[model samples]
Target chain A: MLEIINPSMVSLIQSIIIILSGLVILIASIGILTFDKDMPNIVYVRIHVLGMIDVAGIVVFLALGQYMFAVMYLVLAPFLAHAMANAYFYGEDDYNTLYADDMVEDKYAALNAPDKLDDDAVEDESGEDADSAEGNADETASENLDSGDESND
Target chain B: MEILLISEYFLLVALVIFLISSMRVISYKSVAMGLIGTSSLTLAVTIILVVAGTVLGLGFFKDIALALLLLGVVGTIGFAMVLRRQD
Candidate 1:
């Protein structure tokens, strides 16, 4: 099997693989740069495709006897994936904030219906009257305590 | 070998692509987009350096490329956190 492999042919094949992978990565980088800022899903998909091309390049490097490059590429692959995923998932908070005003109005409209407000208003008024009566009783109790102190003095 | 020479040229092409894209970083209006651009540029440069290392037989360049890739990921996450905090 080893004798059947032509060294020059292997070299050419490896070179082609490396070049193709590099081109893929380069094109993907350009794609990423030009991607729509608003479409995070597309950006994320492109990044994943770029990562696959990077892995292919690393494999080519390994075939060309570049062990260090292969190892480094292997180690960095997960970090890149993690970073891209984090940016895709957690980065949407800014976008949510951008549309928060619209959401707030919709939420308020849903929560505060006319019938609900009428019922809450009546309940609130009754509760306020009761709270005032309780407050008056507490004040009288305090006044009685003060009078008792004055009497003792 | 002629194949090696071609591989080196391809690496150079990739490097040029990375540099060209990186130049557009300032044109992005949104912080997240800018961060994404910066990280992509960093990743491209790292890939170019790894290709160069294989071509030139420089072991250290591969290690440096790995370190840069890790740093790029960390920096991208930090930028994401900053953007979240701003919101």
Candidate 2:
């Protein structure tokens, strides 16, 4: 069904396209991991990197002669990205964090929304960075064990 | 019998990415990283599946990639919601 382009030619195209996309994905993966600690909102940066992956992947699919999936992803990718961003900033995700807890109790905090939002974003990034650090596992494991024991009781 | 008619160069690269993203998803503590990593891993798998399946003359791989694509979107939304969920 995909006879529009000669098969051998298609392979040559895919070789160039797929390799490039794969390399892009790899480079972006490195960025995501490497900058996870350094960035203030790593998720936003991740989302952008993922957008690059999406474009590269779509090109790979087009080279593979799969037009439908390429289009499907094109339509859905923005929606998915939006969902992620909205969920991060708007979703009630910060309840467990002490900062969210403090902000929740203060009624007048809404007046400072513009200023506080940036601070909260930075704080959340740092908190999550610390949470994900390799050496911090021992602390989290112990915390989890304590929580598990509490649940058992 | 040789499986795929295509070169193994991209396959090896895809496999490396598959492994790296898999590690990120499992080892990372931040839920957002887990979320992003899982989606990245899914795309990497999709690339591997589509390329290998096409070269091997298997149409099912494309179908599987379709399924993975759909799930990747659904899973991204679910992860975000889970992250946003009130504790």
Candidate 3:
């Protein structure tokens, strides 16, 4: 019960765990960003960092012997966030190429090459068709108005 | 206090597993692999606390159990949201 738990010891453990976990999380983030490799490696690094956060959150909760509800909420929220992010980012291809500027440029050139049907060409074609349709509609409306005037006269 | 010490030892072991499993999570591109690692870490911590409570007769197992349940719910909902948002 509350009567038996040592508040100071709990606080000390909480502080230590928080510090250690925070350091691990920090290192893991740095490693992740610097680790410019495949998706598996990236995902592994991300999970490691998340694990630190997870442990840190739990330790903090245990340390906060009284504010169980509040700490528990805080802990769950971040875990949920991390899990969602991980699953979303890693659920697809395990080896997504980290597209760099060179890759982007290459993709742009390939997609925009002459004699090929591309998104830009399709957009332009649609735009021109829309304009022509609008012009025809305007002419028809004008003719209708003129006929109406003639009938009135 | 005795329970706290036992919990600390268990947590120490859990931390070791966490650190190792974290590397696997980062290296493996599989979502399942990452989730497995996460589960291992979760289970280790939860079991440690539960065992500590039971061994010490601390009468705090209910609180720990509730926390684990809450974690499970949050994890499921979070995964669902991820699924809904996926392209």
Candidate 4:
């Protein structure tokens, strides 16, 4: 099967992949075993290490030239990670995580604020927007004046 | 080839790693850490399956690896849900 490509090169890649996958699993195992359980936010740390497991799994698939499995695993690993993450996120009543605490929404608003101001700057710079705003203001003022004239008459 | 020999050695190392991770999974005191260990265990199994398949010339092991991968994700999710409900 590998004769289509350089067999030695393919073997080298597979060897490297297996070695790397072993190292990743070893590290993940250590982290899972030795990480401080007393920390309040330990789940995130655990999840981070577990991500290496997912990466190693993908590489091992690629090493075996199973692109389809690699792609499928890639697509699904995030969902698994997110599940583990959300288990922490929604599980706590006092969940003070940033996502649950509206940090993301606030940051999103903060990020979009400058864009909003930029839109206002565009409105200020564009003659059409400025003219339309002025036109509306003038129409309101003229309507007020006409009402005053009717009252006076 | 030396590369294939080296790959077999690493595959052996990976198998050992898998055993250690499975032991680690059994040893976690905390639920969250246990979940982490579970994920690592599943992933380690997936890696070993591929390694065994490759060295043994069993192409169908890739399909089993794929199934295990999907099962890992599903199993983790299911475990997380159970944990969430308990909390």
Best by TM-score: 4
Model 3 per-residue lDDT tens digits across residues A1-153: 787668766656755664564455445434544555554555445546555555554554455353554366455655654655556454553344344445888889788787665766765555455445455454355454455456558
Better of 1 and 3 by TM-score: 1
Ranking by TM-score: 4, 2, 1, 3
**Among all candidates shown, the one with the greatest DockQ:** 4
Tens digit of lDDT per residue, candidate 4, span A61-145?
A: 7777778878988998888888888776767425565555688888778777988879766644543443444554543554544
* Candidate 1 Cα deviation (angstroms), residue A1: 3.0
Clashing pairs in 1: none
True contacts kept of each: 0.35, 0.42, 0.02, 0.69
Candidate with the larger TM-score of 1 and 2: 2
Worst 10 residues of 3 chain A by lDDT: A92-101
Q: Which 10-residue span in candidate 2 chain B carries the lowest summed lDDT? A: B1-10
**What are the per-candidate TM-scores when only chain A is compared?**
0.48, 0.54, 0.36, 0.58
Q: How well is each residue in B10-77 modelled by candidate 2, as lDDT tens digits?
A: 65575576558557754666666666667777877877888778767798998999999999889888
- Model 4 preserves the real interface contacts to a fraction of 0.69
Residues A1-153 of candidate 2 have per-residue lDDT tens digits of 567789666666667766676677667666656764555666677778778878877887786688998999889889878777667665534533446667776756775678888877766555455455434564475454445456558
Local accuracy of candidate 4 as per-residue lDDT tens digits, B1-87: 577667666766865766686666557666665676677677777767777777778988767877887887888899889878875
Candidate 2 backbone clash number: 0
Candidate 3 local lDDT, B15-34, one digit each (tens): 45555644655355655455
Q: Deviation in angstroms for B43 in model 4?
A: 1.5
True lDDT of residue A51, candidate 1: 70
DockQ of each: 0.26, 0.22, 0.06, 0.54
True contact recovery of candidate 2: 0.42
